[model samples]
Target: MITTKLYNRYQTVIPSEIRKKISVDPDSIVEWTINEKGKVELEFRKRLTEKDIIGLIKQELPYNSVEIKKRSGRGLDWE
Candidate 1:
């Protein structure tokens, strides 16, 4: 098992081995939880970006920004 020392501010750096194994990065979100058996769990998740949701919405046709503006009555010059 990997071990790390808690510093004065009650903070500990996750070990490199564990970080690499979990693919943790600077932008990763850490979730801490305690199971019913009192075992601490750490979940690492990457922060979602626009690129991640690009294809989340199913579309029958390619997105057209101009068409969207026209439908919204904002005109092609919409800022």
Candidate 2:
């Protein structure tokens, strides 16, 4: 296992090897959690914005447009 020393203000630098493996960058978000066994788990999350989602949607949709499905009936139909 890799070990690191806790510096002032309880901050420690994540090792380069770990960072490379996880593809972490300056803007990456890190999540920390403690389980019932009192073991700490770290999760990496990539930050995304509405603009990013719109771009992804454009790529996924046909002709770069959003198609809404419509029903014939006016009200909700329950069988």
Best-performing candidate as measured by TM-score: 1
Model 1: per-residue lDDT, tens digit, 1-79?
Answer: 7789999999999889888888899999999999999999988889886457566789897686556546555433534
Per candidate, the number of residue pairs that clash is: 0, 0
TM-score of each: 0.65, 0.62
Q: Roughly what TM-score does model 2 have, to 2 decimal places?
A: 0.62
User: What residue pairs are clashing in model 1?
Assistant: none
lDDT of 1 at 74: 45
Best by lDDT: 1
In candidate 1, stretches whose alpha carbon ends up further than 4 angstroms from where it belongs are 59-79
User: Could you give the C-alpha RMSD of every candidate to the true structure, in order shown?
Assistant: 7.2, 10.2
Candidate 2 stretches with Cα past 4 Å from truth are: 55-79
Error of 1 at 65 (Å): 7.4
Q: Supply candidate 1's per-residue lDDT for 4.
A: 92
